[model samples]
Target: MTKPTLADLTAFSAVATHRSFRRAADALGVSRSSLSHAMLALERDLGVRLLNRTTRSVSPTEAGEALLARLAPVLRDLDDALDAVADARGNPSGTLRINANESAARLLLKTVVPLFLKRFPSMALDLVAEGRLVDIVERGFDAGVRLGESVPRDMVAVRISDDLRFVVVAAPSYLSGRTPLITPDDLRNHDCIRQRLPSGKRYRWEFRKHGEEMAIDVPGVLTLDHNGLMVEAASDGLGLAYVPESTARDWLDDGRLVTVLEDWCPFIPGLCLYYPGHRHVPAGLRAFIDVLREVNH
Candidate 1:
């Protein structure tokens, strides 16, 4: 069998790591079609099928997974060695992958991402936006961003935002015919657009006032997974939604939606960018954190 080139090995690893050619290509700054062709050529040259591809998904075969198990650490070490040389010169250069929620990612794009890119033009970043809180270490990400309250205890977190509040909101049309929402208990008399947690459980609406706290499994026929979607549903008069106050601000301003039970909602912890405390922080990641601190401060 012909030996695979270094580029081939790295491309295969990237595809397997991302489980999609499109994402892998974006990470590598290549086109998906070219990446796909490279994988086919690499597999043919090695006389082994490394990837199982479908229209919607991709997975590494057993042989591919075994090769990746050994190859990944070697590639990571190679990157670190190269980055170390750059770091010595005070230049952080390498791919920095961050797994982040949509909200946090948006916040970073507005405040942190541009500055980091402009300052470290030689470096690259892959910010994967999703709602689920994933295991960043296992997923091969340099870091992850999430709400401070949701960050794992073991990781080192850099605060990116201040306290935030989640409020209950409904369209004025929906609220007009319903019983007055003076307290959390009155939510049971109306339809609530329930939020589905990442873990496949419905998020219980939480409320607190004075010394009393309540978690309500709100009544509703419709359930949505995203806060943005929940806010849209509430705006459409489908049902009431519990969402970030900032997310509902525009709708509230336009008279499409109005807040209820405002006395119950309280400010909670803000967003954070977190990483594994045990591993060596990549130079690019450290640089990014510095930028975060500078911007957020």
Candidate 2:
């Protein structure tokens, strides 16, 4: 008797549900040719034609339909049983992969993880501190953190932080000898520490006042992609930096970094935990999101 493999079952199930090799291939993140080949091998092993393939479409044969009908619920129960085990543990146990910008990740590290671990000590968090917006589904991330405004419409987002403001801050030593910059336009002459986006482009500094918004491509001598690095450089008097007010709170209180253009900087949306819609959200993820909501509340 030939033993059934999980891969064979998964491939069969995907194709059965989608009814098309191309659609199944797209969902499984495999080439159409690979899916077709797998089906062929599966048919060969069983000595039966499972699918009636045509130039335009593919449909399961009667035997294949019967097999799928018997297997689907069993597979579903297997998955549910595994999930139940994870849920029965009460505390999540597994590696949670997340993609986020440097700033958002820092915020999460400071506030979210402590509480998360308190509730679910066994869960391991792997954070990729990146500046690029990654496709969470394609990249295989459980979730991603981003600024609320930056999250796509198709994604479901939960606000993790209150509205945050970006402020222009400079080391007291750097501002000592320079002319005081009261307006956003004054940034044109000053050396600002710029943030280079992951797309190999400079991030424009946006300012708004009295309902008027403007994006300024400020000239700068220092540029970095990491927000923490930019903060350090600004603290060392490299140049004025546009940073989140939350991050500069310590520097501002201690008189290390002076806030400039305070009126121009206004509160925008804050950090959000976002993920794809329609996908089966794991129980672990559901619990984590609930924790986030409780903490935020």
Candidate 3:
């Protein structure tokens, strides 16, 4: 009997972890047919039916589950060992996958991305902009970027920006005939543009004044998942939008959108780069973090 090679183990573990050949193939940057062939070959060599497949889903059999339980940790340790060697070389060269929200991605692109790339030309960055929070480790990402307060307590977080502020703004045309908004409650009577979270829940507008905080579920004619689109909607006279002030800066500066209720807007903790505390920091991630600190400072 021949021993299973590293490639075979990696393929099996990816499929087992995701429970979907298509997802595993995508993650591995391989074709679905190729992944299927690898798995079949692995099963043939092992002489066991390791996976139970159906039209809708795939799950590992008992033998496969046992194998997976052992392989995951071992693979992580092997990768760590390789990373240690790479670190010894004093140069970062590899793909650094990051999962970040739209706002964070925009902030990084504007502030640090160009400099970071110039400083580390050999390193590749894969930035996935998402509206929802994701488990970076499980998703095979090296790190994630999100508001400091939103980061998981178990992860190590590094501040990448100062406080962020939200603002309520609308085009002059939209507010021409409507009553001016004086308080948070006044938003109820206005045609506000709302944001829809990844969980399908609408984001409520939050306000703070003199230590008092209020969250309002503003009535809206349009709801969008992206802040840029929300700003555009407000600029087009669709409705008032409560968005990160940075997102609406250009429109506000150009007199296309006017801000209201500035005193009520709160400055929240800024975005942070976070990663699992237990894993060894790869050279690429370490270099990226250093660049982030340099640019932010």
Q: lDDT per prediction?
A: 0.91, 0.83, 0.89
Give Cα distance to truth, residue 155, candidate 3, Å: 1.4
Candidate 3 lDDT by residue in tens digits, 72-114: 9999898888778877877778788899998789888998889
RMSD to truth, every model: 4.0, 6.6, 2.1
Query: Which candidate leads the pack in TM-score?
Result: 3
Better of 1 and 2 by TM-score: 1
Residue-level lDDT for 297 in candidate 3: 82
True-vs-predicted CA distance for residue 241, candidate 3, Å = 0.9
TM-score for candidate 3 = 0.91
Q: After superposition, how far is residue 286 of candidate 3 from its true place, in Å?
A: 1.4
**In what order do the candidates fall by TM-score, top score first?**
3, 1, 2
Best by lDDT: 1
Cα deviation in Å at residue 16, candidate 3? 2.1
- Alpha carbon lDDT at 246, candidate 1: 92
Tell me the TM-score of each prediction against the true structure.
0.76, 0.71, 0.91
lDDT of 3 at 175: 88
Tens digits of per-residue lDDT, candidate 1, 196-274, equal: 8888999999999998999999999999999889999999999899999999899999999999999999999999899
**What tens digits encode model 2's per-residue C-alpha lDDT throughout 1-297?**
256588887888878777878767755668989889888888888888888889997888998899899998888677667668888877557666778988778778887778887888778777788788877765557799999889988998989888999999889889887888977889999999999888999999999999998899999978898766777889999998998887788888998888889999989988899988866667668878887888778
